[model samples]
Target: MKIAVASGKGGAGKTSIAASLVLAKRGVLAMDLDVEEPNLGILLGCSPGELRPVHQPVAYVEPDLCSGCGRCAQACAYGAIAWFGSGLPVVNESLCHGCGVCPLVCPTGAMREREKVIGEIRSGFVDGAPFLEGRLEVGGVSTVRLIEATIQAGESLHADDWIMDAPPGASCPVSAVLREADAAILVVEPTPFGLSDVAGVLEVVADMKKPAGIVANKTGMGDLSLDDLCRRFSVEVFARYPFTRSAAKAGARGVCPYRSEETWVWKTESLWRAIERRFS
Candidate 1:
């Protein structure tokens, strides 16, 4: 089962929880879908292996075979093909969604698909467990596409357990990861800021119709009641973990605290059992 660990805001310990889940379940496929800032691999204590470029078909015209029929321009509803009075259309590569419609309507077969590198996927291992991550190229626009590719690459490994570290916030990238997940583990701090942010994330998770439970982080601190929010959303309280100086320092050094912290390991195991109950 692929479980997504996400939050509406940053610094809510989502990635830590995901990493902990990986420790609890050995030989799992751990994926970091946060293409822009992929740090879970760091926390996993593994560097990504050789990078594999992910390509998508972008429409380009072959000038030699061009008829300038204008059908290619007409087929593009995204205005990716900019038409000049009587000359061949210029393709705005950034604006192209790679729909390949231009090729379908080209009369002279001038339109062709060229593979453009949108991002890179890396397959690696953390403590003998499969670890996968995706990193979008600089100035890339296909965020969700890359995220989908990362998830698909992880699935290709065919692991029985999967832990997905999702990017924070309720953006398309987050949706892309959470929508396909078997369940979601939402981590929220008890601060006012975290509470406000988590409210929006809960709506997104609910809309997806995915079973979710809240992991209350920094349980002893903050005034905002995460329990109230969980009750409001009718979500189960998966785990409530207290703050510890060791956990914070270990995380700062790119170490997986769950590996050494017995309390953390137990909490994560309990969290896993609670979440798995929902699946059954």
Candidate 2:
């Protein structure tokens, strides 16, 4: 069973909850699909391993074989190719979506597709448990592709239980990971801003028809309640963590909040079991 720990916005305690769930049991495969800003490994105290490059196809022009037909530029829907109508067309690597349309429209075969390194996957271990994380390269635009690659790599591990730390928001990157999960745990603060953020994600979860529960983090810090939103989505609240000075201090010091306090550990374990009983 795969459980995806996600949030609609950043700084909502998603990674902390994800780490707690992974620590709930031994040998549970933990994957960080937040390629742009992956911090699950740091929280898990994971030891770094081999770095595997993740590739994506991007359009490139060969000046030697050039025919300035401008057809390649015209055919590119994303305007990745720029033609002066006299010389070789300049292919912008960043704008290229790798749709393979540019190469097809090239009459002189000057346009070609080349693999570009968009991100790297790091495989490691957290207390002997397998951990995989995807880190997107700077100026990378293929976040969805990287996320998909990360999920594929994790699937190869063949672990019975898995916890995926997904990126924030209901965007394509988050959907890419959540689409493969068996269930999801949405961590949210009990505040007005937090409510709005989670509402967007809830719509996505509802649209995907995925079973999801809520974990209200920093409950005492906010006066607003998530009960109405939960009722609207028919998502039950599985756990709650009150705001505490120690918890905040521990997180700032790169410590797992659940492990820092005894009560928090019990709360996390109970939440895990409840999730297992419902989804497994």
Q: Candidate 2, which segments miss by more than 4 Å at Cα?
A: 84-87
Q: Report, for all candidates in order, the number of backbone clashes.
A: 0, 0
> All candidates' lDDT scores?
0.86, 0.89
What tens-digit string does per-residue lDDT give for candidate 2 at 53-170? 9999999888888778899989999888888868888989988888899889888888899899998999999879899999999988888998898889988999999999999998
User: In model 2, which residue pairs have backbone atoms overlapping below 3 Å?
Assistant: none
Per-residue lDDT tens digits for candidate 1, residues 1-280, read 8788998888888888988888788788899998888889888888988788998878888999997778888779888898875678889887777987888888888899898999899988988988999998887777788998988887678888888999899888899998889888889988988888988888988898888889998777775766678788889778988888888888888987796678898999898889878775
Score every model by TM-score.
0.84, 0.94
Candidate 1: which stretches are off by over 4 Å?
A: 61-92, 101-112, 260-262
Report residue 245 deviation for candidate 1 (angstroms): 3.7
